[model samples]
Target chain A: MNATQSLRQDVPEQGGRRPGGHGAAAPRPRPGADRDSAYWWEAVGEGRFLVQYCADCRTPRFPAREVCAVCLSLEWEWREGTGTGTVDGWTVTRRTFHPAFEAPYTVLRVALDDGPALYCWGCLVGADPDGLRRGRPVEAVFTDVGPDPADGGPTGGGAFTRVVDWRLRE
Target chain B: MAGTGLSGAAALAGVGATPLSRDSGVSTTALACRAILAALDDAGLGVGDVDGIATHRVGDSSPPWVVGPALGITDPAWHLDQFGGGGVSHAVIGQAALAVAAGVADVVVCYRAINARSEFRMGGQGRAPAGAFDLQYQAPYGLLAPVQHYAVPARAHMQAYGTTHEHLGAIAVRQRAHAAANPRALKRDPITLDDYLASPWISEPFRLLDCCLETDGACALVATSAERARDLRRPPVDIAAAAWAGGHSTYSPPAPGGLGDDLTTSSAARLAPRLYAMAGLGPDDVDVAELYDCFTWTVVVQLEDYGFCRKGEGGPFAASEALGIGGELPVNTHGGFLSEGYVHGINHVAEAVGQLRGDAGPRQVDGAEVALSTGQPGHILAGTSALLLTAGR
Candidate 1:
């Protein structure tokens, strides 16, 4: 009757490759950056993308959490990256139970060198579908759809409209 | 009967559900209400007679308060909410029975509904925004989605037992085949093991068809006192034995000694002996079963967990063709959550009631008096709750 076992199973491995990956590759949780995540959103507002990093460990953070998961460091700084990442895995959704995501949308899990693996909505910028493979290079392309006004800003109106929640650069 | 001012004297007098389907084109709220009203009506009780209600917490639905009044309940004397684990629903049902048995209320209804169609467009994850708690474990490795979370265990199950992917596919092959005959099922057409393997991969080891269909619907039951149940409209099916627990024998958080890691036992294995003792029957006594099938591999897991098959034998045991009609035991006659709609385990219970009542035309087990329904949500392991509802209890 250990009540703890009643909780959800499947605590993800901190990072890939088991033991060594735990050294520093703990993934940054989503909406990861604290109040400053507004910047990530603001950046998205301008067709630009950014991620938080531990000022100490230089580990990239995602989903914008308050503190760095790796060193438990609260100190973080925002930085620009090449919207580039590697595909770890992907799924093409055919049937949808929800309305927001139209079917056939591809959800990909990509990896950045210092950050933990990241899962996000992705669109292949320009490549043959047959060539898709794990570890293949990918770069994020601003949807150019612009920032969502409901997202604490103006409707599709921004210099760059940091659109990709998390996208590959190329 | 945990001595909470309630002596566990409750009994299941009635059960009901609307026609099961992927999309009724009805609001989930309406779906919930319909099931509640139908259960009440089946018990020869009116909505006003129910004092308490329990739901699986289908997303975006009104709370018990709003649901009760909308269904014409004047002032419910009892209202219960249970979630966070698939097994919690059965525990709550037993608790409601205890409540009614203790005279806390005359009738208590347990139900669940979901616009899963609109909420879980992807079975891998739901509409819930990522939280700090879950994100810590999930967002990394892109394991944020539940399907992938469950895949870990399924993979371990494969690795530990040498169970082949085709072995898992056998479950799908049998289940959907049965679902094809079930008039109320969503995917009534047949699917082959080849179809399952040929299906596109969804997070590896899991194919598009290996998952349960996203559905919108509801199911409910009216549990009353055994004495009062005899006088109800439909025959009152006595809940002979009901029990629920959170962990297995020698349990641990990460599953001590990797035994729990094998996916063979936990929550269910620990609960099986108690359930058999309570029901006064062995696994051999069950004539029909409706184990949860959120995933095909899960059915094999529960088959072993519930003691229907040995721990390491689930894959091979389930591989035998004896599961369907003309098999050793008829199972998932309602097509299970795989082919039938997923309303938590409520639909399984309703289908069990039908089998016991001999109302399941083509899918019915000839004199099915003993039925078992079990579940595990998000790896939240709460053991089994067995109901021995006989034609004569």
Candidate 2:
């Protein structure tokens, strides 16, 4: 298996659900999905990254909002991301804020190549931290996270939950 | 230039705080009462004279209603219990000044009482509260701490301007030197740039020394009309200007049709002109600056945004002797949040009052008359606030 595949396997895919359900590891913290972002999270679960585009102005936004900040348009539609971006900035977290994340992980702020300066943040896997710099090209990689038993997961149930991270472009 | 009609109409008569430390061994209520009482005493005013109280918190500290009754204020004419963090620190004081100037209240005390260290540590692990729309995007990736959130922009500034680690270390070293003369500062042991370089990284580009102390304390300020302030025991520091602005934050991407976020700049850029214009003063008139130093990069970016230096020059500006007590423009005369305890930027206001009052002693800038104090530069949280104060009414 490649490094990316191995790293993906390391994550608690079934939300810590084990075979026979005898010893389940603790579930990682799930995103607090609400009405505005439920659909986007649903798409993310299906291994598709979506960006919200205002119906009127055609302006794209991330971390979905109810109204278009530019045109005040309440109407919007989802456009799938190109799964490609450029690193605008990044940080190497030496301190652990969560048990699921270990020390020395690099978090990146990447500007989407498909959208108008829309930036998203995610963990940088399958890459060395030393090569990180502004404008470095990257591609999105999605990992499945099963329905969290604690809160039925972001999609509420029966959906393939996933999270997006990044890897340097080959 | 006439300001928003609130300029110079109200003045800060007194400033007080509990000794800042990692642990205060008291409830936030007790801390609030003590600080408020101390400020009232400093102003030579009693609880009977107070008709308004204002405070800001983030589900961690006492509110105005609880603190008001604790200080024997049963029915205040006006009170504001704002909900926020360092971003709204100056806004609370500004709201108090508005109450006093508009005659909605005779005497108003603005306070912030937080047990940040002993209780709700900012960088500590916790679930993101409901309605934090932005955290839904960041928290999943373990981007939970302010240090982590701030590191993104700090690195962006470095990449854009060639700002180096030495440039950031200079700020830590200078603030520590200033803290040496401040008896109230928490970390007073002098730290060299070498020491700062050797400090462990909490978030990359942010060494342990780059972050402010998570402190347990409360700070209070008394505001009254300029007429009432002139008769107070301490010199009246006129509230020359107060400005607050909100825009795209690191957590939220810049709007597609709006002004693109300049990662190198901060909300302070939008606030500086408004603040100076309201005060009818220019940046050159500022004798001492108590700019927010939540992290070393904040001070650097603010220096550029507040017109102390040109864009991309903040790193060089902070690295020079210009930030010293006798330099061209002394900054963080009370050691700032970096060395002085962090009451979440409220202490920066108190220190600004001290410098303008000529009561800062060894850290006091010579013949200082004007002071500029600010809240968080709006790296993480979008809201940012600032205040400009003059020595006398």
Candidate 3:
């Protein structure tokens, strides 16, 4: 069997953001929307992670597509989400893309339970031995993992601060 | 032609390229169509008879029907898009060959185009230790960027084989020399091993010269059967063997939790034997090689992994340009991806075709009969591909 097939059940997984809540601290210059992604970005600013719903099929879609990649239905709507999913794949970055961020953080592609696959590039864990398994429940959280002036954006203070973009929710 | 030992049926008949500039000034779709049409014209084939298209995985889209309609052809037999990402252009040609060989199609065209220069904004990004892959794994501990990734392996190899950085410089010098002769190469500056060593380091041991110049361009080739090629204006280069495979996927389940595939064994290891067997030859029997060299060390790794030499012998073997003209093997006579244009690995196959067809202008390998070309993506596990070509049927 291939490596993934051999992975046991009950292994913990996390993605989208971090494991805990950031309470409430919205930062400046929120990642502006581009290419039909305003709704998803706006909801994130409202402290609620959400995905677009194909109004035709009522299925969640990610990366904020104007059309449902699955059904190709143009009718669309927004849906609040718990942001839970299992880890599909991940990479550990030893350096940040910018100076304000730390290196060696995890980037994850998480499969959401609400029915859309999401790719998130941000810090995911503290230095832990627990492996990020293929299919474990995780919820979103924000964290202060960078030196950016946003006292509350994910990874802001360069500390292992956990904000709830995602967490291993039991 | 079953035991067709020593018959040279394939010759790269034509080679075409789009310009390499910061902003390519055209849509990727437009660039691909132009490159394909230009290659067909170069090979003396008209658009009406064209019926096949193959493209790179990371390349811009080229819908067969859309491209066929634009090129003014109808009902092209087969259209395929391969995604080994970078460095699989030459390997894709093998698929085109199968189409014609099996009578699925009579003519095949392969092409690649990328706006990395514009889309990724890669330039002026200092060649510092990027620790890109290791940023979360080892870069925070100081392992960084392409050079640093390569450096780790270089250091491990140094300890194992006593190889030095100077040995690696020899490869850079020879490739640039080939580039100096090709007017299309982005880097035409004359360089020597001394110039190689003197250039400042981007990361430990790798200097400015040890890297490939990323460009914005597209290249294409037209392949037809040897039987029909005789009637065409340009001779068709026969495809003896073509194959490719991936090394390790960084995001797969095998990486983070389990011990991944060994980095020492390359992507080529999976496909090389079948390719050689199909061509009825081995590495030693081949006349020339156009191994991919996105980085200087990639050439070394491929040389050993592809059975040119024993593992760890690559560094010393490279020092003499053993693959250049008058050397045991003449590799990358077109300067390869290192000094040549990096249309992924498409240019390598074009050069091989040129050498076998005796079309290479100055840097040609004298009377090359059997030419082997290959590409590998990652350092250890590669997305490896190979091609074997001869002059005629």
For residues A1-170, write the lDDT of model 3, one tens digit per residue: 32122211111232223122111122211232344654454454445677667798676655565676557789988777766676543344333333322333344445667753343323243323146554656666543222224445342222322223344556
Deviation in angstroms for A167 in model 3? 25
In candidate 2, position B215 carries an lDDT of 91
lDDT of model 3 at position B202? 59
The two-chain DockQ for each candidate, comma-separated, is 0.07, 0.52, 0.04
lDDT of 2 at A49: 83
Model 1 DockQ class: incorrect
Q: Native contacts retained per candidate?
A: 0.06, 0.61, 0.00
- Candidate 1 matches the true fold with a TM-score of 0.68
**DockQ, structure candidate 3:** 0.04
Q: Please say which candidate is ahead in lDDT: 1 or 2.
A: 2
- Candidate 2 regions with alpha-carbon error over 4 angstroms: A1-26, A152-160, B1-4, B126-131, B251-260
Residue-wise C-alpha lDDT for candidate 2, range B258-328, written one tens digit per residue: 32456787888888888999999999999999988889999999999999999999999999999999999
Model 2, chain A: how large is the TM-score? 0.79
lDDT of 3 by residue, B118-141 (tens): 553232133222222213223222
In model 3 chain B, where is the ten-residue run with the lowest total lDDT?
A: B251-260
Instruction: Give the range where candidate 1 chain A is weakest over 10 consecutive residues by summed lDDT.
Output: A7-16
Top candidate when judged by DockQ against the true structure: 2
